[model samples]
Target: MSDTSGALVLFSGGQDSTVCLAWALSRFEHVETVGFDYGQKHAVELRARDEVRRNITARFPQWADRLGEDHMLEMRGFGAVAQSALTADRAIEMTEKGLPSTFVPGRNLVFFVYAAALADRRGLKTMIGGMCETDFSGYPDCRRDTLDAVQTALNLGMEQDFIIETPLMRLTKAETWGLAKSLGGEDLVDLVVRDSHTCYQGDREHFHDWGYGCETCPACELRAKGWNEWVAEGRPTLAA
Candidate 1:
């Protein structure tokens, strides 16, 4: 058995959450992961999640031993109500409008509500996520202020003391890449690009200059811009 100070991470099998997972392994005595099955169009994302669990377990089997198998909590029904292009029938369009069609309404809210319950039951006071505002274009839930409000609401509704920790909230995507490289060696970036899921369309068969980032989409554009800047600064690029 590991130590008692446990943490529950809302893992999405993406670059940011993978970094958080590695960070959690180093900090907590016991670290557990919770992933969602939100019925996103790309079933490949779920497959990617499985791959991420396998890789994490292989890398840190001791942590796996202590934490048990990765818990992929199912919320398939909830996804039916998610009308956003990211998880629904609508086409994902790039826009400078208020929010993108990919923005799933109340996604973070739903994730943390369930995470709070799980954490409270397991005596885990810390709940970590990978939501970032710096590079995020228009996701309301990814904002720092939105997270703070949700944190307060979760504590009030649950009547339990819990901390929603967002280590990547303030860091730009480039900075996040740097942090992951620092923590898990430079090779970790390659692991993220190959294994992690970030595409709104859920395309995984191709690799762009910025890993799986779809070159045409806004997310891909931002990620590509950041990676180009990082490389222009003579940073190392993780190979596939």
Candidate 2:
């Protein structure tokens, strides 16, 4: 059974997941984080994960005590099995199957499954994910329906009720930036922009207002577009 007071956040050290982390910290008394290292092309995110956690704990004193242990799950097996642009050093493009080349089949499903397993061990009933549908690469696994189904299957198979919370599910990237501001103000937004890594091509040499990424990649383009839109909208803050 899931507890209402604590949560496990699926933190990827990217802008979106970092916002989700702050979101979890704002509401939950106790929050833990879990990240997967599936041999992603952008493994720099792995490094950013620790930095993001440290930054959050340091910058948000209110959440310092609430932030609990961080877990990094190694899934080299997943890397081998779920071959895609992310798991391989391939060109980032649209696949013949109509999905982004970076779309690793079942990646989110596997992530949630493993995250649930870790949560079970840690006695965490709630899971916080940053999966977005409004401004995403059309990954089937990022959809709410898919996550809901996975949640049901997880509960049935594990004989435990786990709540999957996707704060960014219905939000656009611009709205996500607004959310970061809402959750932790300018500090959080700056931290996300400075520390997060979201480029599929794993480019950290160039920097953008949104974050560090390759300007041409789909991920970077989406982030830049969102940042610009949010800026043009007077950078309005939203209620979390």
Write down the TM-score of every candidate: 0.88, 0.97
Each prediction's whole-model lDDT (CA): 0.76, 0.90
- Candidate whose lDDT is highest: 2
Q: Write the per-residue lDDT of candidate 2 for residues 1-240, one digit (tens) a residue.
A: 245589999998888889999999898889999999999978999999999999888998999999999999999898879898888878888889899888899999999999999999999999989999889987999999999999999999999989999989989999999999998999999999998888887788988778888899888999999999999999988789
Query: Total backbone clashes of model 2?
Result: 0
lDDT by residue for model 1 over 161-240, one digit each (tens)?
78888888887777777776776666566677678877666677679766785577666676677778776766643321
**Candidate with the greatest TM-score versus the true structure:** 2
lDDT assessment of candidate 2: 0.90
In model 1, the runs with Cα more than 4 Å from the true position are 1-4, 60-67, 94-97, 236-240
Task: Please give the range of 10 consecutive residues that has the lowest summed lDDT in model 1.
Answer: 231-240
